[model samples]
Target: MTMKRIAPLIVSLMAALVAVLVVGRPEHADAKADANPGAKDVIVHLFEWPWASIASECTNVLGPKGFGGVQVSPPQEHVVLPGAGYPWWQDYQPVSYQLQTRRGDRAAFATMVSTCHAAGVKIYVDAVINHMAGGASTGAGSAGSTYNHYSYPAVPFGNDGFHHCGRNGNDDIANWGDRWEIQNCELVDLSDLRTEAEYVRGKLVAYLNDLISLGVDGFRVDAAKHMPVADLQNIYSRLNGNPYIFQETIEGGAGEPSPSEYTGIGDVTEFRYGDVVGNAFRDGNLSGLQNLPSQMLLASGDAVAFIDNHDTQRNGRAKLTYKDGTNYALSEAFMLAYPYGTPAVMSSFTFSNPEAGPPASSNGTTNAVNCSSGWACEHRWRTTANMVGFHNAAYGTGLSNWWSNGGNQIAFGRGANAYAVFNRGGTLNRTFSTSLPAGTYCDVANGDISGNTCTGTAYTVNSSGQFTANVPANGMVALHINARTTGGVTTPPTGCGTVAVTFASSTTTVWGENVFVLGNRAELSSWNTSGGVALSSATYPVWRGTVDLPANTAVEYKYVKKNGSSVTWESGGNRTINTGSACTLTVNDTWRS
Candidate 1:
């Protein structure tokens, strides 16, 4: 779909590929799937979204919803193919290393990166390093740089910098059977860079280093299979820091490059994951979905899982996409709830033509995203967005309380923190067993939880950690400890003088975890983890939040790290704070643990 000419081939060859263990990854490829530890673990690919739009979304939706990172489309000067109707794939053809594209200019891109970081969201760029513009695209590029086959001058690559494999009379990759040609020759007549050469590698490293200097946290290596593993390893080693790196390696036939071969360099996008998980939901089968990790090609830590992506959604390879309606929603929810690989949710724009670009001007400058009109915004769907909380809440816990109806119904629990049930057959009323504590929980799947109330459905778990409810057909019921109903700060007792107390905690955290302040007082949620006042990571390494408290009162409080389902209390005893008669006060403390 992106002019790689490999999508259809990979899709048809999926049946022949086999899953293998990934071993012998290079030591330099210590790229983690979760770039920002202690943040949420989900990465939403806002495909073709403008830089400015992404910044706003980070502050408004992603940060609030607990998403970890965003895989943005390429942010470099690329080819502009107006004659081809300004196809979406045009962005894949590079004209230069300049950070100027349809998305925005260099200044805007830098602002986006800073804005997202301030909101606790990391940015992963889609790095297209396999080749430059195709030989047929002869003209000025998006940033007015002109180039021909192997003659780009902006980055100053010449014919000597490319690989002319001298095969098939045109030097194009006509045979996928040959491993050398697949990696060295031009893909679809695009000029392939000689990655083995030190000069070429240096140029590539500079491009990547430039992005890293701009505070880009990670990269989705586009068309990584075209470059050898050694070349990638060498390039990665040269990076300033170990930002998260996941490559797009479409599994090929037996002799061709295997996705497993690239795992040593970094995480690989497990295309097979989409097939196994998507088909399970599309077929309405819940029996075999639990064993997904063992069935995947890469290990849980090395795989980047997704139900559908930009390429698959355009091609017919994807089992269920945004077009599939409820089935797709259920599939996304299941992917999040199930403990598998690192999840990257897809948020895309609507398109009937697989080659069509997003809504843009005649000059191919992409317009700002408008979700209600052209964008699918699948990540914002109630079932998908709310499930992120479930994923975070259930982090580090293993699946328990597994139950199935031997048909299209299933229920499971994530330790004692979260529980969920899916009903695809019919409205089945049943009492579900769980390990959650007794409390009234908001069913996040059907509604949003605000304060202590649920906007839609609510269920009460008894002391035995069991709840009785009728799950609707084609629906789900999800509850996490964070969504429990609890009355918080009951109108700060009538005549008490209030002072704004700002709590600042300097502590580090792992993925899916956040810092909160709670204490033994009505104003501080009374030590209820569910009702604790959450601190923001706007100024990271320093979690800060302000809350009103009774003046001139001694409050026993402590900072705790909370994921959705579990709470990790600070070591030692409780921290005591005094709210003086001053109108406002600030308390700065380090993490005791």
Candidate 2:
């Protein structure tokens, strides 16, 4: 459950029916692929991290680690419960769609998205749309919008906006087993929005589209199970573009609106997969993880996998977590190395009390995240970070040359591209066959390659394509074609993936006047009007340039027709282009909208 603190039992209801997604079914289906078209396939859940911190992390840790995307905490304005020590769950109680919160203002959020996307890291905002503030409180929201139990002025939602489940103005879901009541009733004291109302659906879709326009790659539909699937299909159908959408339909066991019911819309978080991976790692059972509980879940292509989310970590239901130390790392390594479903790594702030808020600044707003400051930052750990790269290098390839010591130990190759081994129990010597063509390789799990030198243990595979090595207890070792230094079947690391920019100008241009792209991004021109990358007018009407940029990047550039000393800039908002997972992508856009 993404929301916990205040009402554990209510979240319990959420955690039960936790995840769902689908694609390749029909027009209703989102594409049958990972969120980001060609991303690393590893999405990190940076829970409650401040915007600037998230930006810094995207550039330094996450981008370099090859993480495809970041699932940031909800960015919408919400309740600020200082009276309750400002519980973290308070943010989950959204008061309005205003992009203002303890994290940052609307501008900060937009910058964070562009920055992360520029670094090849997609941003998936946690969208808490199922309900608003739970208790019957009368106060101004974080964005200074006044709100009550049945009224929210920021979104201008009134009495007609909420569901009338009837209980002294509160409609608590007394019976979770009843699908209708669960969907229509209030979760705790929270006022459930009447999503069936056209006004409500429009407002919600508009808010989501605003984020998409701001450049977010996708969304985590918080408490999606609480809303009717039909309402969801309508809302998503009307989105600007197919942004990555995964829902939180937490009715765990087989029951009403099975995960398949939501599959036609977007990817679903397979909570059961988390339980399986967590338990297997915690208990050192490699075989149990081989066959997942796919009977009642969506297909691998439709599922978002995670080891332990916010709620499961706090509620003691997860098998491994930051508290578990080595076991947690081992489990995460397994999650990435194994090709089960789209993985989401949880990077939460360290908290002693479940209800405790983030480290606040002097103004009581969430402080700038300092990983050293009680934040788990699990996504930055050596094992997890390197595994992200391993996953990237290995994705699009299926498992081969699979080897297991029958139970607690296992080693597998992602075709011939990657090979990883995990020794959950007491380990020493073991030999495994791999598709790799016999060569010395660097063990990225221990230390990555620098220059062309290996910083850690180097394993040499014989001509027979077999390597014998001793793995540590509860240790993980991963080596992929993308991690190799010198020889072998390694593909040189494509650093700072590039994107192609083609500008088609509608403006009148003379023989001497040439169109050039310039922007605040260094790749564009460092905002220098004169030094902007000149576009080729091979085809008089269109100008183009293949610009090298960081993967998953966003650039705000404008086309300017330059004749030498003088320049005519496009008179409009800066045109933006967000790059994807490809080594190089093409952005065909007009000069100015």
Please name the candidate that would achieve the greatest lDDT relative to the true structure.
1
Q: Would you list the C-alpha lDDT of every candidate in the order shown?
A: 0.79, 0.73
lDDT (tens digit, per residue) of candidate 2 on 1-593: 44442220012222212211111113243332223334466889888888988998988888777787888888888887667777778888877789988889999998897677667677888998778776656677778877767666666655777787874344677765677887888777777888876666667877887787676767999888888887887777656434678988764543455666777778888877777777788888886555554432668788888888888888777778899998888888888887777889999878889777777765657654568767888987888998887887777787788777778988888888789888887965888789876677888889877656778987877777788888998887788776666566454465644443334454557866877778878656687875665565544576654444556777787778787588888788877777665543556666552
User: In model 2, what is the error at residue 182, expressed in angstroms?
Assistant: 0.8
lDDT of 2 at 33: 24
Which ranges of candidate 2 are over 4 A from the true structure?
Answer: 2-37, 167-169, 254-256, 293-296, 489-492, 496-593
lDDT of 2: 0.73
Q: Write the per-residue lDDT of candidate 1 for residues 1-593, one digit (tens) a residue.
A: 24442110001112112100111123344332233222256999998888999999988887677677899999988887777787788888888888999889998998998777656577899998888777775787778887777777676655667789997887888888889999988888877888776666666777887787677777999989888888888778766444678899988896688989887778889999899988888988887877778888899878889999999988789999999999999999988898887899999888899988888777776654557667889999999999988888888888999989987999999999899999888898999999988888889999888765679888989989999989889989998887887422311122213455678899899876888899998657799977676676656789876565767999999999987589999998989878876545789999987
311, model 1: CA deviation in Å? 0.6
